[model samples]
Target: MAHLAACAPLGACTTKQNASLRSQSARVVPRAHHADGETQAASPALTRRGALAAGIAAASLVLDAQESGAVGFKKELKDKRRGRTRIPEEEYTKELQDGVKYVDLEEGTGEVVKKGTKVTAHYDAFFRGIDASSSRQARFLNENINLPEPYDFAAGSEIRISKSKELPLPPQALTIGVIGMKPGGKRMLLVPADPWGYGDKGYAEVPPGATIEVLIELLSIGEA
Candidate 1:
């Protein structure tokens, strides 16, 4: 196994290691799609809030998967030269629209992530540089760099809001980006630096007007 680590502000540091992929044992909930592009889970037995809480509880299962040595809950892609897992990349340049862009690296076989679905995923967020030739290799902002510890959160849930107009809103782009993903799926999201990402003021590491690219891998989806 190989471990990758990085230091960032807010005490956000992650260590990722390569491991085999395996399925987690959990109940599956039926998923439904809405006209607005949001997917919803069918859970009449539980209230909306209850369903949300149940979704969050599913995150614990990710720990079990990790303990089993399945870092991203998926197969490892090895880079022979560096002796590390290789990240799948887009073949061509993708233009960003609607303040975001995403590409699926691996399609998951599990249930689709809908509203109120608790999702566990691993992500690496990078700062898109002003120079096109150097953007892909630019510096990262926060969260996991290449380490694959799963981040657990509910889709469409409001987390924190930035009170300052200069700062970007929290959880907006990320929540919307992960919707419809299935367990084991890997996706790359490009978020514009406006209301969707670190805004004019940015953060301690992120600069103003810098775009962010996030690579996300869905580890598990909790039963509704």
Candidate 2:
């Protein structure tokens, strides 16, 4: 896989808001597999937001995770092209339960990530659209423009929301999204705009109620 890099503090992209709106909640509903081995499920209620108080609490949790060695990253890439493991095309596209959909691009070889596990990875996020041009060439919200180096953070840590016009969603979404992944594994997450992403009032670049497609590559996982 190719790598891109840009120099900017992660905090610069997030924002804090004072409100009591409920944060989106999703449960890992398991579904039975068909002969094709695909997982399927009905959609759940979706809303995205983090109360200012919750944001502060989540930040505290991140610091504790870091101190416990639950979050960290590598400065270099061992193998950029071929990750540690790979998943089959059909298997990667299997149907998912709940509203969130995921396709495992690479099946990693490291330990499965748990709640407190520290993780290192590179992510490319874009707004999904139906129009050909919008869908095919959507701009990336966050990506490594030049280097392969990955960012380190706790799997369940809550970072501040992006400062861009986009409203902040719950930080746990990333944690829940990457739970079963191992180091070197890559997955594409189709996050519903409602509860999992920006709600009615979309960000400056993304429209209201637009689904967000996030390509996450797990570089490494550390001990808790």
Candidate 3:
């Protein structure tokens, strides 16, 4: 600490409101001056006072004014994405007819389950027979359970209750029961009040004697 000060004059370095910012790389974006002195682009150095806001606005403008066709890229991609997991409307109609109930897995794609690979995902779950519409009363997480029993697969990989409840096997997870699913597939599971950890007593969030439903997606499995 003394070495740096000794190397320079006492007033050479001083603290200022923007002293911290001054030491760091400049985030300002310069504006381009056209023939009329109007801006075609923002100059980071000249953006002094409103640098942050100006940079953000400039970035937004740049992104907004991207190649005309680029704006439609998202819509186009969505159109194509509809084809990836796209269940035909006819299939949906068929499901509506059969009365078979299933929550169309959201963000259910992009899973390549082999023997062992790590994964992660979030799910919204609820018990069945609770009006069949909307009644999400409980949520649980970090229910890490290693599959194929007893074998350590990977660290930091997580499997939620909904996903774990489906499988028939286990090595003792926070909760028992998750749909045994393939790598990329997502599942919704319902844990009966009895089978769930709570033997007799129940709590506020979770009913004392009520079944619980969970939704989960296998994010990844470690390489074996």
User: Per-residue lDDT for 11-68 in model 1, tens only?
Assistant: 4543331111111112345566789988777666656878788878887777776766
- Stretches off by above 4 angstroms in model 1 are 1-97, 129-149, 160-171
lDDT of 3 at 160: 36
Off by over 4 Å in 2: 1-98, 129-149, 161-172
Worst 10 residues of 2 by lDDT: 16-25
Total backbone collisions for each predicted model? 1, 18, 33
RMSD of each: 34.6, 36.7, 19.4
TM-score versus the correct structure, for each prediction: 0.44, 0.44, 0.28
Q: Show where candidate 3 strays beyond 4 Å.
A: 1-119, 123-179
Give lDDT tens digits, candidate 3, residues 104-125: 3543444344323433333333
Worst window of 10 by summed lDDT in candidate 3: 169-178
The residue pairs in collision within model 1 are 16-147
**What's the C-alpha lDDT at position 204 in model 3?**
32
lDDT of 2 by residue, 35-147 (tens): 89776653333211335567889999998988665323222222332222333234446434357678877898969988778887666555532211111122345543232
RMSD of 1: 34.6
Evaluate residue 144 in candidate 1 and report its C-alpha lDDT on the 0 to 100 scale.
Answer: 26
